[model samples]
Target: MKVRDKVIVVTGAGGGIGRELVFNLLYKGAKVAAIDINSDALEETLKQAGGDGDKVSTHIVNLTDREAVEKLPEQVISCHGTVDGIVNNAGIIHSFVNINDLDYDKIKLVMDINFYGTLYMVKSFIPYLLDRPVGHVTNVSSMGGFLPVPGQSIYGASKAAVKLMTEGLYAELKDTSVNVTVVFPGGVRTDIMKNSKVEGVPSTNDTDKAHDHLLTPKEAAEIIINGMEKDQYRVLAGKDAKMMDKLYRLSPQRAVSIITKQMKKIINK
Candidate 1:
């Protein structure tokens, strides 16, 4: 699972942690196939990599399109020669609104992008990955995916699906060279809200109380890639995600109550 010399395919590689992963993977001497919906952003990621960009391949495609997702492995192999791993890091959140007040289309959008998009990448890439001597798949689910956030119930449900799906994949692929890692990140400092087209500031629990206690994209990517190399079954990024995982495991009702109090401020604002 070490990324060194591995041909790894990364979705959402245009920005945020995905962009950071491209950089770190290059630093590790991995042949990276960077996939994103935005061509310009993907170029920017390559630009940031400086000379290391030579080791990377950039693909602009929408994960929501099954055909596009399915074709990625072949395109990557054609460009990078082989596939060894994949990072399902693309995801989005619905606008901060209660389920009752939100449109069902918004819910579907979240589900399609966050849950099914990850699924498409996994299904399309797994056959190729299985052909390798060893491969790893890292699926990013949110803390919201597990714990209840008042205005983000639908978003939570979608990520919850990803959480369960990835675990199921782990069980099925346990005997294979392919490894599965499910990541739960707390609050990451990224442009995901803006990328998701969600306007306005979120109710943040940052130390400053103005931003989410956000882990930088590079920090989060390092933890994730390191976890993949170590073949960890689960990786929790950020202190908040670790704390919430423990709290929710011990008392789901209490956890939900705590989240509601914090989220109410954001939703009402």
Candidate 2:
């Protein structure tokens, strides 16, 4: 569905692709409700909106808080009159470590924010989306969701859950006005490690080299919004994501091995 004049809610709108999405949607003439846990960051996004700031509203929301999320739809409606689309973009990764070394708390935190967070947004807003003439649900998964990345097993698992759940939602809503899209993004330049409060992250030259080809947030957001506009079933946000998706489909084991080698540079031993 076209976003022009529509009220679109974007989670994680404080920074990275989510912030770029807010800019792009406003450029397309859409009103946006930006949600993020950081009030200051949300304010920054609004401040950057400049003349378009009037078309946006910022909401401080921790996506992991289900009660807060459940109240989001009504709050958005109250501000924007009605909501037509939701981009489930808020998520985080755990400290780079094997599942064996990862504690339960870290695992749960990853699952809660990455998988369950998206689930809550979907559940809370789907009913409202279903009622709209042209509604959309876009969930951002990851390349790790489809390919195994050593030391990020739990992070991959959470994203894999998002992948499957979004696909299922697509099938269920096929006959309805609500369009569902699942997105897989490869390396994107962002402050995810800092935002996730991940410890012991390597800043070695090798690690930087490994991520030198990462997509910019604006590029990733453009691909995602284009997919949403076309009502695509799946969107691969980077060239790496697109290539890896094909490789994983052809030979999962080989794909896993390839990524394992590349990730070794950054994964904490």
Candidate 3:
């Protein structure tokens, strides 16, 4: 489970937390296959990885494609000789829109990229992971996955699906050496809105402006990798997520009211 000297494949390795994961994993002495849809971005990440080029490799693939995902385990094996774990960090946000104003196409798009894409990678890599004496899987689900966000309903739905799917995987793989972890990341300092290509809205959420407590990508990555090293079933990055988890558990209606009020203020503004 420790990434040190282990071969780990990471998706969405172009920027944000994914890129940070690559840098951190390599620093921890893991043989890394950095994957992303943007070959140029991957190149950028590779360049930023500094030395240890021998321990790092890059791959370009769209995770939504099952056939493309199916080839990943083999490609990583060819590059690194063996696989030890995977971090499914690739995801996209939905256009900020209310449920009634939402476009079905947009919902489908987010679902394909954020939820099904993660599932494709898990499905493709499970056999190989099972074959290994020990392996790990980490899925990045947003805090919105559990706490319903007003404008990002579809995005929340997608991530919520990932949360449940990952939890189910952990139960199924309980006896196996493969550990499953689902990460709940609150607001982190990243260009996720730009990456998701949001239009006609401020990139940051209303609450983000009120509280500048976003975690840095590197910090988030460190927390995530630490959880992976320990084979944790759940990893909450950022204080907001940790706090929200407790609040939601304590009072679902009150939690929804608090978040919905913040988002509604932005919508009405």
Candidate 4:
């Protein structure tokens, strides 16, 4: 679908790829509703958009709040007259702990935000999107959705749910005007790790080393928009993400083992 002149709602538009996406969409002539829980970060994103004030709107709402998310479609429609697309991008990571030791509350929080948030957005926006000739839903999964990571098991599970859920939507909407795209992004230059809900896990302080080959948020957002325009079913954002996708498809067991070993190396370092 053409992004130019589209009315798009991007959740979690305060940081990382979401922030860049808001700016990029504005540049492409799309009217954007930038939603996030962080008022300060959302203001920063609005400033970065550099557009006429009417072209952009900001909503500070927690995605995990079902009542709030349920009311979003009407608000967006009232603001923009109609909704052409929705990007389910809000997410949170759990503490880097094994399932046995993982905090139940933290896991619940992660699942509610990452998995249920995407579902809520899709559920809330479908009617509005169906009113359009062609609409798109871009749900951001992760490389961990396909590849099992040692410390982020819960995070991976939430993304896995997104993968299946998005694909299910694709199947259900195959003959419809609405399209679905799932994104699998590798490590990116985001503050996710720094702001993640990790309790006792030591931060990966060597940013340079940890993100040696990470893509910048701008680059990742560009890839996402390109994929959305083309209506790709699955878009891998980086070489590592593509490789992981290939490995998982070729041999799930072997891929899991390899990724587990790699995680061991990173954690031990």
Candidate 5:
């Protein structure tokens, strides 16, 4: 999809990759509707975007709430006149814990925000997209979506659900004007940890080891934009993401073992 002049709506626009995506899309001449639960962070994103208020609009919405998500299309349409694309970038991660010991409430929270949130957005926007000749939906899954991470099982499951759901949407919409793209992003410098629900997990920690192999949000956004333009079904955001996808494809068991070993060190710390 040519991002120039496209009317785009990005959820979780207050944080990390979402914030970067909004800025990048704005620079590419897309009118953006930025949505996040955090008003302050949304304001910060707007300030950083440096676009005319008319070019960028912000909405404080709790994505997990189906009612709120249901209203998003109308709200976005009111602001942009039409919706050409949507980035389901809003997500939440639960704390690292064995399934047996995991807090059910927290797990529900994660699933609601990460899984149902994506579904709600897609459900609400598909009608509008169908009206147009072409539309795009870019969902941000994670490297964990392909490989199991012991402590972050809930997060992994949520993203895995997203992966499959997105693929299903792609297969079903292949002949249509709407396109679906799923992204698997490896480590990146972001505030996700601070906002995540990982119990006993530090709000802030050095990700230097991961950063060495991390793709900046700008890089990831570029890859995603290109993938959407080319109508790619999957977009791997970094070397690590691509390698992991390859490994999982060649040997699922071995890939899981390797991811388990690497994640053990982080979770056990």
Candidate 6:
């Protein structure tokens, strides 16, 4: 669906890919309702918008709260008059430790935000989306969602659930006006670790790094929006994600081993 005159709601709009999505959507002439848990970060996103900031509305929302999420469609509709699409992008990874060493509280937190959060947004807005002439739903799953990373097993599981749920929604909504697209992104330059408050890891804002190997948030956001416009079934946002998706399809065991090694290196670092 074309986003030029549409109103799209993007979660995790405080920073990272989510913030980038808000900017891109606005530049594309789309109105956006940006939702995030961090009010300051959301304010920063608006400030960055400058003159076009009026096209964007910021909502300080915790996705895990079902009551809050349910009210989102109405609030967004009040702001933009109608809703056309939603990008469920807010997520966090747990500490770099084996599942055996991880606590239940941490596991639940990851699932609640990554899986249940997306689910809440999906259930809440899909009905409204169906009411529109052309609507879309984009869910951001990680490369770890498809390829297992030893240290991020729970994170992977949560994203895996998102991946499947999105695909299933696509099938279910095939005859409807709402379109569903699931995204798999590899390592991206974002402050997810610090935002997640992962134990044992120092607060290193990875978003500052100009590493060519990692996909920048702006790049990732562009890819995602492009996919949404074309109504793609799934999108691999980065070279690594594309390569790894093929690798996993060709040989799941080898893919798992390869990512396990990479995770070990990150954990040790």
Candidate No. with top lDDT: 6
Task: Indicate whether candidate 4 or candidate 5 has the larger lDDT.
Answer: 4
Q: Write the per-residue lDDT of candidate 4 for residues 1-269, one digit (tens) a residue.
A: 98898999999899988999998898888999999999999999988777456898888989989999999988887888888999888898876678888878888989999999999999999988988999999999999988889989999999999999999999999999999999999877777776674555435344556666878888999999999999999999998899888989999999989988977776665
Query: How displaced is residue 94 in candidate 6, in Å?
Result: 0.6
Which model is ahead, 2 or 4, in terms of lDDT?
2
Per-candidate TM equals 0.95, 0.95, 0.95, 0.95, 0.95, 0.96
Query: Across residues 35-141, which tens digit of lDDT does each residue of candidate 1 receive?
Result: 99999999999888883545888999998999999998999989878899999999888788778888978888889999999999999989988988999999999
The reply for model 4, stretches above 4 Å from the true place, is 199-207
lDDT values, one for every candidate = 0.89, 0.91, 0.90, 0.88, 0.87, 0.91
Candidate 5 structure quality by residue, lDDT tens digits, 173-214: 889999999998887666687787445654334655544666
lDDT accuracy of residue 108 in candidate 1? 83
The parts of candidate 2 lying over 4 Å away from their true place are: 51-53, 202-209
Q: Per-residue lDDT tens digits of candidate 2, residues 167-246?
A: 99999999999999999999898878788888787532235666678898889999999999999999998889989999
Model 5 bad stretches (over 4 Å): 202-210
Models ranked on lDDT: 6, 2, 3, 1, 4, 5
Cα misplacement distance, residue 110 of candidate 5 (Å): 0.5
Model 1 residue 71 lDDT score: 90
Clashing pairs in 5: 1-229, 95-198, 95-199
Candidate 6 root-mean-square deviation in Å:
1.8
* Model 3 lDDT per residue over 45-131, tens place: 988897455899998999888899899999999988999899999998877788898888888889998999999999989999999
Q: List the residue pairs that clash in candidate 4.
A: none
